[model samples]
Target: MPKLKIAASLLAGEFINLERDVKEIEKAGIDLIHLDVMDGHYVPEITFGRQIISTVMKLTKLPIDIHLAVTNIDHTINGFMQLHPRCIFIHPETSYMPIRLLENIAQAEVLPGIAVNPTYPIDSAKNLLEYYGGVCDVLFMSVEPGYGGQPIMHKRLQIAKNLRPFVRGSMWIDGGINPNWAIEAKKNGVDGVVSGTYVFNDVQPMKLNVDSLRGESLSWRTP
Candidate 1:
């Protein structure tokens, strides 16, 4: 089994002190920084654009896993690739030509991935996952795409288990990914997790939460 990694979502970080939060997460050994690039037309929310992604690039050297939840696939793809994200994920439902876009991303030497919503049929994306030397990966959504802080759709976990054998690349789960859910995802062949509120929550220190999500023993720091 591949190692399970924790990707801390920047969407749930402190906007006022974004750089600081990113640095702290880097110190805590986060595997990647999950950036949600949302366009208001596709998803109800508007989030990071090229500008914010550029600034984040300066903040940390960690690999960036950009999730593009936008309608204009060509335009959005053209814009974000300039920043050279480690992995670029697009929602197939929003794209008119998802396979082409995935191929384009691979041709550019950037990792390509598809984001499958809760209702998208798993088999619908099977061919794309096998395309272009199997560079295409997957981001399985456990909740709706537009917003955060939603509960994990437990049913989706089974999909990951069922598709694990067919996926040549990584499989990740997003939304409501706490320590317990992270464990469950791993059991279901998920290679990584995108955690927002749970990772950045204040009740427990971020490092402790990150470690716990990896199934390490919890260590406390008394105030």
Candidate 2:
């Protein structure tokens, strides 16, 4: 099994001082930076663009993980690639040709990932995996993607559990992932988690919260 890791979601950080948040993440030694890119058509919200990604790259050396919850998959991928993300994940439902898009991402020397929605069936990923399973990472959303601060869902966790055996590469759970949720995610074969608000909440330092999420501490409580 791959070692569990945490990707701090920028969407969940302090928007006013995002640079400071990135610096704190770098200082605390979190695994990666998760960028949530949203297009209004696919997801109801709109988020970071290339400029934001560019600014973050200048702020920290941590790996950047781009989650494209957007329409026009190819265009978004091309625009974001200029920042040279470590991995780029796109929704299968949004892409006209998911397999081809995955191939293109690999060709660009970036890890290609597929993001599965909370309501999506576990079997939907099997076909995509059959074609590009070895080269791809699977990200399961524990809540709906467009918004933040939603409660974690049991059905979503079950989806991750069900897909664990078939996934060849890493499996990540996103949306409302906190320490307890992360523990369940790890048990169900999740290698990494994408956390936002819980990680950047005012109640605790980001490092400690991040550490708790990774199961480094069991006595974590909000201040």
TM-score of each: 0.94, 0.94
- Per-candidate Cα lDDT values, in order, are 0.84, 0.84
Q: Candidate 1, which ten residues in sequence have the lowest lDDT sum?
A: 214-223
Residue lDDT tens for model 1, 82-148: 7888999988877788778888888787898889888888887765575545656789899989888
Q: How much lDDT does candidate 2 score? A: 0.84
lDDT of 2 at 130: 81
**Ten-residue stretch with the least lDDT total in model 2:** 214-223
Error of 2 at 52 (Å): 1.0
Give candidate 2's error at residue 219 in angstroms.
1.4
Query: Listing every candidate in turn, what is its Cα RMSD in Å to the true structure after a full C-alpha superposition?
Result: 2.4, 1.6
